[model samples]
Target: MQTPEQVAAAFDLLADQHDAMRWDLALSEFDASVLASLEGIATANVASSALFLAGGSGREALSFVMHGWKCDLVELSRRMLELAECRLHKFDLRIVESEAARYLADTTEKYDFISMVGELVGYVQEPRSILRAAALRLRPDGLIAVTWVDSSSLAATRQTEEQGVVALVERDDLEIRAWTCETMQKYVDAARLTVVLRSGRMAESPRRFWILRKEM
Candidate 1:
């Protein structure tokens, strides 16, 4: 298995190589389900007419929204936020480069559509807290599209032995938890949210996508 440090280093390498890193390759290597969700997001347009992208990197998603849904992207990385700004200069995109956790907690801003791709759920220190808080801010009938790695997979377990740019290392150094589908669904129900879509996909880590709507 590759070391966790090696996984991080690989992303840094991608950042150096492509102006925008290709996570689709990583997802194809882990779980196939990721592609389906991406395709879905690309096609679906929210009724609230407002979409929010969490942990957005570069601007692939925001580009979609700018051209399709007319929404904003909020992220945690300063580097990513800036790069997105540069890429999305022509569009009316909003980028908030603050800790996603803090933003979720402090945000009074309500969104009709919330998208969190690329295991954004696991990236936060408290995935449940962030999800629940975000759920509350939604207008009833608002949608939360969240994806995370299923802990059963080799990549999720950090047991992957694959070579050539796959994340093999367990990021134990990052104080975050890996979640399975059931665990995430538990959090969704606990947040008093309703599940509208439930399915798994094959991506970099056997990713799972959930489409949730806040219950009135």
Candidate 2:
């Protein structure tokens, strides 16, 4: 319900706070679950493949790569990219200072893995559009990971409107468009992908994460 720019600015500040929430065990549950659920794909196989992280500002997913997996991140901010680089300097990470959906939709490039995290999912009106688009960027048998807010989750009940930045979000019914695990399935089902993994609701904030693989 907040302006995209306002939300981005607020998150940028939070990124500086400690990034504690980003790496929380519950936070990684979505990622960990998706990784575990995929039985056909070898863990190392997906990890070693090329990855596109739409809306990967601040490079939280980059840590996933350096710490365990191996993949590149796509972000929309130069400043965020710089910070990500600083934190993930040891890996073979590459970045693009543009929106992930924009890049995948406009370019001929394809990846073996794609992670649509935080800002991208947290702010889109059509989160599925990004997932469908990301699916296009994947080669056959490639995997796409998507995370988004679960609008129906009771988690939001405790988050008073006053907690976010002042006027941080708009009060439009548009928030109803948020994608939860239940609804997100429709998107993946509609897309030309096979749902391989899915997870959500690890914390008070209800966010859904899905892992899909392009059919062979």
Candidate 3:
């Protein structure tokens, strides 16, 4: 299992090529899905604040900042955060270089909108705990847009399972934990979050996208 720092190192190695991939929609389904979901959240309620966890290269934060939302982006990789700063320097974005879990633990401020997309959850050691922590930082009516990896979807060389949690090893430096939709929903329930929007329930895809609201 790779620690958060190890994962950050792996991402740092990919930083040079990451921004290019983000700009190309055809190659970036994750960005497209997240942006489309953001539009939905924007239409229903005009969110004034947003927090992006594991936000890479400022593409998502860029959209929120452009619309005048006070944006704070927390990224683990130094290289990635540097690139994000270059893109977001014009805006008053609070870009921080810290692991998402630690930031959530230390920050007392709450947000109206929070996004934990990319491999934020999968790369973490305690996925459920992180989700619960994010929920605690959300305002009552706030929305959380996130994505999770499906355990069965990866073509990993070796895999391990324990109590429904699966660790997928694709390469020496590339390892991610995954969970089934049912298992992930269980985590959401435990966190007191309700899923308002789900991309799909099918197991065909490796990643699952969801928009959650703190349960009243």
Candidate 4:
């Protein structure tokens, strides 16, 4: 796993190309799905505040802000946050440049919704600790949404051995960690969050998304 500094540097280097690469990978579809899931939950539960972890370029944050939701976006990459600032100028959003674990540890404000998307959960070395921190900062009836790449899948297994770490745009090292669905579930369960909604398309890749709620 890459340290926070290394990960931030990698993302900073890729900041300019992030949106184009995402579009090329058709990840915007998955992002839309996540936004839809969040929207549904927010409508049903009347969510007002949200905390978005590792929010790259703040696309999801833009959606939340547009919908009249107060958002706090935490990203490790300063360049990414710069882009986000440009995109989310007139919204109720707070942009923080810090690692997710550190930010969660330092914040005492509870949120009605929390999200760690773009497979950011897989990049964490101690995912369980992060989840626990998120759980602690969540309201009793709040929701947490996360996504992970299934490392046990054939595609990920092949990539793990071949391109574990590579240079994106020949600028910085991009480290990819192998995190299976079971591994993610174990962490979520350990954090005492119950899975309420799960969806993913495994035909081409092992990327999956899940929405969890605090156990009552």
Candidate 5:
């Protein structure tokens, strides 16, 4: 469980290498697939507005912006937002440099969709609180997408010796908590959000994504 400041510092330090490192991990493809699935749901639901939590470098939200969806991205790292600004200059994208939970707490605006992509929820110390706040900002039929690493996988087993915290970029001093899919599911269920879609595999790396909707 990392604090907002700690999470921000870690990401700020990695901002420059973030894109390259993520690309190496095949995260871009995974994100694209997630976006494609979300797009289908959005189209079916006639959703036009979105709130993206921990939207790093704004890649995942770029298509939504191009599709004329009103998009607001909440990211903790100023450097990441700077990069996003550079790439998304033509669009009126609202980029907020704040912790996702805090930003959601302060906003009264609701959206047709909200996404916490790339396992961002895993880094939070209190994911349930974030989910609760997100639920408040979600429209009645809107969807919330969350992704995380599954704890029951071989990857999680290997990380157990390190207590689920991994050092960033091989820097032994800085580490972030690695959350499990079960733990994330608990939080989402506690927030009273229903799981509408589930995807991903649990073998070695074990990444999982879920699409949730607030119960009427």
Candidate 6:
């Protein structure tokens, strides 16, 4: 299991070319649909608040910010936040320098929407704890969008069972955890969240994108 420091260091090294590399841009594009569907849903004339956990360079969070959602982006890498600050300096959103799980656990502020995309769950050692903390910080009717490494993939399943970590076929040096569908359901149930949406073309990708909400 990769420690937070190790994960942060890995991301810090990628901060400069992160945006240009266009890593996970497809997932970001898919995330915008949720933002579009939720537009103008804030109560009492207040803008809907959205939290971006492990949002790198604020790229995916841009959709939420541009949609007029009040946004907070939490990232562990100093270099990433520096670039995020530069790109989002004119915006009103808060860019926090903290681990996602710690920020979720510590924040008193609740959000209408929380995004843990960019494979944040898969990168972490304790995804269940992260999910639980994020769920606790959500307002009623709030939603969380996240991604996971699907153990349905043969490579992920075999590697995860044998080596304890699955290496990304696209970036072999980057190792991550994978979750089976049943395990993911158990985690979500433990967090008291219901799956609102689960999407991915498993034939094309080993990652699954999910949207979760508290039982209302």
How many collisions between residues are there in candidate 4?
Answer: 0
TM-score of 4: 0.85
Of the candidates shown, which would achieve the greatest TM-score relative to the real structure?
Answer: 3
lDDT of 2 by residue, 26-112 (tens): 545655564444323434563555665643343445445654555567665445666667766777666666666567777786677
Question: Per-prediction TM-score, please?
Answer: 0.71, 0.69, 0.91, 0.85, 0.82, 0.82
The CA lDDT at 141 in model 6 is 78
Residues 15-100, model 6: lDDT tens digits: 78775554344544444443443343333235678898998888767656776788999999899888888887888789999988
Q: lDDT by residue for model 5 over 12-113, one digit each (tens)?
A: 878878855543456555555676886676456553889989988887776678778889999988888888887787986898888887888888898988
In order, candidate lDDTs are 0.58, 0.57, 0.83, 0.76, 0.73, 0.75
What local lDDT does model 2 show for residue 205? 46
Span of ten consecutive residues with least summed lDDT in model 6: 36-45
The full ranking of all candidates by lDDT, starting with the best, is: 3, 4, 6, 5, 1, 2
Q: After superposition, how far is residue 65 of candidate 3 from its true place, in Å?
A: 0.6
TM-score of 2: 0.69
Candidate 3 local Cα displacement, residue 146, angstroms: 0.8
lDDT of 1 by residue, 1-216 (tens): 323344344434444233434433443443335445544655675423344544445434543554455566766444555566676667666677555566767777787767776566665545667788888778887778777766655443332222211232333333224655666777788888888887765443466777888877
Backbone Cα, N, C clashes tallied per candidate? 12, 4, 0, 0, 0, 0
Worst 10 residues of 4 by lDDT: 162-171
* Model 5 lDDT at residue 66: 75
The superposed Cα distance between candidate 3 and the true structure at residue 133, in angstroms, equals: 0.2
Of 4 and 6, the candidate ranking higher by lDDT: 4
**CA RMSD for every model?**
6.5, 6.3, 2.1, 4.1, 3.7, 3.8
CA deviation > 4 Å runs, candidate 5 = 20-29, 42-47, 154-174, 178-182, 202-204
**lDDT accuracy of residue 38 in candidate 6:** 37
